[model samples]
Target: MDSYKLLINLPDTIVFLSPNLKVVDATDEYLKATMKTREELIGQDFLTTFPDNPSELLSHNMMIVRDSLMRVIATKDTDLLATLRYDIPKPESQGGGFEERYWEAVHKPVVDENGNLKYIIQRTSDVTQNVLAKRAAELEENKYRFMMNALPQLIYTTDNTGRATFFNQKWYDYTGTNPDILATNSWQSSIHPEDLPKVIEKVGHSLRNGTEFQMELRVRNGKGIYRWFLTRSIPMRDENNNILMWVGSSVDVHNTREMVFELEQSHEQMVELSEQVQQAYGKAEAERKVLHNLIMKAPVFFCVLRGPEHRYELMNERYQKLFPNRNLIGQSVAEALPEVAEQGFVKVLDEVYETGREFVAEKIKVTLDRYGNGKLEEMTLTFMYQTIYDENSKVTGIMVCGFDVGEQISS
Candidate 1:
């Protein structure tokens, strides 16, 4: 029986080496792939026959391959190389320099009947395409992760069973919570104690029904302060319509909630002030009607300030429109219009209150953050700060009436 002929007929590129790691025989496929002849490779050391290419970067060094083969010889066990880059020298007829190549090499020991290692069979498979494709895929995945982490919202993903699987870097930064803590659907730990129950119940229902999930709830931030967040999630399903994963995000809505609350409070204060004004018009209906019609329909801003801090007591429709959605009632002048403090308005109010005299300012240029976008705008206003007096001639409060004269000034 010709065992050598049978060994050479196997499919993969194969080479037989002596126990001393010297090439003894090689198949036709091995000679063709390596661009080497039987006469040139025979009796040559395995490492010397395929040496490391010094010019190529990150190429596999033969020393590592040699050590692996030695380990197999010592232990009489097979050694496998998962994947490695090795540049192969081209024949002189072709370019004589090395060509880039990747391979999966396997070395198996050939033991004799007496349990002595006599030869080693080396097999190799070309895996260059697979390795390069995997590297490109990794690069693309890294870019996607970077974009997700750059978002201001807290983004996360969960498996079909509602177990938290992945979270973006913003989640860790905003919550200061380790992902390990929420690995097993324990993400509720970051929610406010009062809101956690509702959040869990609603999320559980969504996972069970595979429906859209949304909630406005308070969550504790890294600073240990609770803030409102609008959380929304959607299911990712396979072609068969089976849920595979859930993608979710939480946006901070603290400022929006504050604005809504302030608007509601302002509405209630305006209704109460209207009732008070109506009750004060018990007698002299003609005079009261004239004052009421002028205050309501006067195209100018009108508001009354009371108390030592000059808290907003009453404001007309035009006055409320000037600072829309700002809960001006029950707020002092410095607290409500903080941007006006340095513009001499507060000083004028103080002088009027102390001397019980009226202070009139014309074409006063004031800087205000009109839209709350962190930008200040200059506005010209003609206003009067007049002191109110009770029947006993005691200063009670200040009445401010103003009109935006920016257009007039420009014209």
Candidate 2:
């Protein structure tokens, strides 16, 4: 580890000067580079290697080399690395030539036991590729930030604990909150109270299951209006499926909810109004039919009774027409009509006399031998029965009406 031996035999020896500024040992590599042998250069001075002219490299005044070597010696105990640029005289093949060599050297001060300064150690490294790569990464980071801030949808990221760590500018603009609010309960405050429980349930389930998350809920805007937000979150995980982080997006659905509510309101109003109008028309039609039957007939086709024992009562032309050849005054209908018992008409009349509800039979048809030779004829009779009521709304007797409808039935 002798300095003289290392300096003379080192293959990359550009030059190695002693502390006394003397050429005590010219490196073998230096001698070999100069097209000279060691025997002729071992004890020679620095002036013997090059021309001893005043302006040449070995001259009386080498200002650049002297100043550089002086600075390296003085700064040996201070800065660890040093840089120096120098012009190396190239081979004078056809003309005088020069080249610039930039050297970045690491310098360390060597010391002796007597606390005397010794020769310094230096090492050089090239950094052409490293500097270029570092610059490229800086440019990429700026580009990414620009794109994120310009996004319309809110972009957000959270840790595995469901705590927010990062969100884009769009999220802040929509929510009117800063990054300081992210670690707090600011995000939960934005969600509507009604939708909070479902979002929590699903998010908790996905977190425990180590799966992606998705949810839809109403979120309060800056103006304090609740709007629908469709959130989709994807779990970021390690290779073993352990949760690392989550990424999600929020999209606005305010217009969609408003439109749906409007349609539902319109449908409900239509249903209620239709039912009201239908009931009103049905009642009016029923009343018109009752009034028309009373006033439209001259010699009425109906009659009523009023006193005890169902005595002989008033009759109509239609009734007298049925028994045309007989004087039908003061004659009971049950006695005159022999088929009344078989037709069940008296039973219905008795029920009406007790209940006082108007009871009517639509129609009944009988085939009678009308001709003398026993030829058959068909007749249809419609009877309406009602229990007559007095001034006190008490039942007095029954009213019955009959109509022949055999021809109307065929039509």
Best by TM-score: 1
Off by over 4 Å in 2: 1-106, 112-116, 123-138, 183-186, 223-225, 237-243, 270-411
lDDT assessment of candidate 2:
0.59
Query: Which pairs of residues clash in candidate 1, taking residues 3 or more apart in a chain or in different chains?
Result: none
Candidate 2 local lDDT, 202-286, one digit each (tens): 8898878877676678877677877786677888889997888998877664544454465446545544555655476775553
Q: Which sections of candidate 1 miss by over 4 Å?
A: 1-5, 28-45, 71-82, 90-102, 111-118, 125-130, 271-411
The TM-score between candidate 1 and the true structure equals 0.60
lDDT of 1 by residue, 296-324 (tens): 65567888999668999988888887666
Backbone steric clashes in candidate 1, count = 0
Full-model lDDT for every candidate: 0.81, 0.59
